[model samples]
Target: MHIGLISILSLVAVVSAWLPSDTDLFGPEPQTNATFSNLSAGKGRVVKKWLPSSGKIRGVNLGSLFVVEPWMASTEWATMGCGSSKSEFDCVMKLGQDAANAAFKAHWARWITETDFDDMASYGLNTVRIPLGYWIDESLVYDSEHFPQGGLAYLDKVVGWAAARNIYVILDLHAAPGAQVAQQPFTGQYAPTTGFYQDYQYDRAYKFLQFITNRIHSNTAYRTVGMLEVLNEPVNGQSSLVNTYYPTAFSKIRETESGLGITDNAKKLHVQFMNKLWGSGDPKSGLKDLSNTAFDNHRYLKWDTSVKVSQAGYIAASCADQVASDGDKPLIVGEWSISPADAVEQSSAFEVKSGSNSGFYTKWWAAQVIAYEKQQGWVFWSWKAQLNGDYRWSYKDAVEKGIIPKDPGQAYNQGVC
Candidate 1:
């Protein structure tokens, strides 16, 4: 598809006023009336009762924040001259311990602000999936000096912010001690030998989860954090290891919470595990013995090279087939976007410059609403993107341009759908 660079850059002018600078986005006063103290003991879930007609996990991923990917945020890692770096860990190492810490200290504050959380609630998103790596934990056997301190504190700040806005948080461990997937910077892997299949890596990952669970249990505000995902996109062949780790971590987390005297049944957190390659297999088959668990699947229509159909046709076909296979599983579309992949040709349906264009927007919108109704809920791939023409993938721009409904509840019937 042809990208209209002029049209995309002009949007920067429209959003510049709302974007966070050295000045706070919330201004002198906060926008949310909700407080953590009054936050219901009932944490969000994907099961039957938890499912709202609006959609369960109706949210978007806070990508390129905790997990630094070069393409998404090149300036953040630019200090290391990491333009061509393979992973976040490698980028940090290249920057050296001291420089890396200094860069992150500045970035952690600016990358995302409290106002962003307020905006999420204002626009219809009810949840956020924050992806973080194992290195953030002080107890993990990693290069502590390289990673800046107060990582958990930052996380707590986000939880509190979400709680104040009455939004749910899903603490996703995007990158484990060793990488879980290859050819992806989010995995935080530099060496080929480091991966989930290794016993030592698995052990450290489990410990990190245990530590995180304890931290959440201790925080009153963080009770808004309703779900804890074990891992993200393990290599396809490692399904057996992932299957084994799911129950082990699930039981361990429950055992840890019980030991801490946190017995609120409503706040019972669901442990989420992704099926091989984003719901390629039956989640029930893999998680038969586990309870209080849910399945996560990423539905990126553009990425499926096997399907060479029009955008609307592909979306309809995929949604119909996947919805049928979902059956009774508590499934969540953890990541999805309307952006076409790479340099390949995009469907003529989405050639328009503005996300508000009906031909491009309606098809994607209908598919998502249909998917949410069929399964538990869905979280879009990203909350924002750079001044690229792919406005559909950028939630902020989409909402601003009236492409996506400000109230996600209204998204079901915004127009042509």
Candidate 2:
């Protein structure tokens, strides 16, 4: 639970030699590889190809694990003296560093275990998208920052367990130094003003990216961590963030790979970026100058207010979605689940649709899997909810109830879509 300030800050010192100055424009070299043999595919601008073996990545997200969102673990949030706090930053502030660290230590210890990974393998899931806060490298976190320490150790356990089960890990930077957007607990804090665009915040996030990219490639414990999602759901309107930040991140990751002698096309981690943004732009345009990356697409019909509420409507929407990216890059549905409610726009996403009629959820799940296989693949929004026992959001619950098949690849209601 203590900070390893020295080791964490060393990441900056190392990457500083290759990092581009803030004023300089950054982009990728022209991609030469036609098709990345096995891992992920990126077109246009890329270094080494890291295409998937199965073409599609069948996975689930380890939600509310490293970055604790209170609603998902309400009981632990309250018992750990975090009931009043929405984000881990606030929770640490309220509980004081020591108590919060103890709570998180225990929470992370059991949130998901080796048994969970075994279950995933049994269910035929091959990947886990883990959401981590920047504070995982506690040194970059300012003294004023209030996130708990010692997340990296827990992450080590996770990847080790995952690798044993032949499951890959997609390390996602879910939270940044300053919240990427204002008032979002998932970003690690909720505040009226967003500060991720500031110079210092951008630098910290960059350092963390360098740190993780290096760790993924260097550590034997992280052998199964084949993907590094650069950032998760960053604010959409920042042009500089999309243009400069992304290219720089891509460059830094390649630099890390080079430093570690990871020149092979197959051994590299697939750097993932959002396929599209709300206002700014997408990877195709922003990252036009780079490759050796994958695009992330998060789909949800509940908040869309675009898809109909009826059962057939959900199936149609799933079948109609374009899982394939506009460019040649692999498209990953990083976060998605069954949105059963009508016209409700909540990121908390309580889709407890499977009651007695497993028929409905079974059919819908198949429709999505069938459709998503067109591109790289999809990872469900979550593995399980710790407290609520909501079947829709819990892959374990759904699997047990026969809502989602034990063998996820086998679509129960095949051709139903």
Which candidate should be chosen as best, given TM-score against the real structure? 2
| lDDT of residue 45 for candidate 2 | 18
Assess the local accuracy of residue 50 in candidate 1 as a C-alpha lDDT between 0 and 100. 17
**Each candidate's lDDT (Cα)?**
0.63, 0.71
User: How high is each candidate's TM-score?
Assistant: 0.80, 0.84
Candidate 2 Cα errors over 4 Å, as ranges: 1-55, 277-280, 342-354
Cand. 2 TM to true fold: 0.84
lDDT string, candidate 1, 1-417, tens digits: 111111222122111000011112122232344221111332232221211122355788988777777776655557546667777666666777666666666666777789898888888777788998887776674544244444665676777788687576788889887677666778765556546677687788888888777766655556457678888876555555655666677777777777765554444567877754464344456555555566687777677776555665666655564633434456778888776655543444555463334555655665676666467777887887664555666788777776777877675564433
Clashing pairs in 2: 38-51, 39-50, 39-51, 39-52, 40-50, 40-51, 40-52, 45-290, 45-291, 46-291
Please name the candidate that would achieve the greatest lDDT relative to the true structure: 2
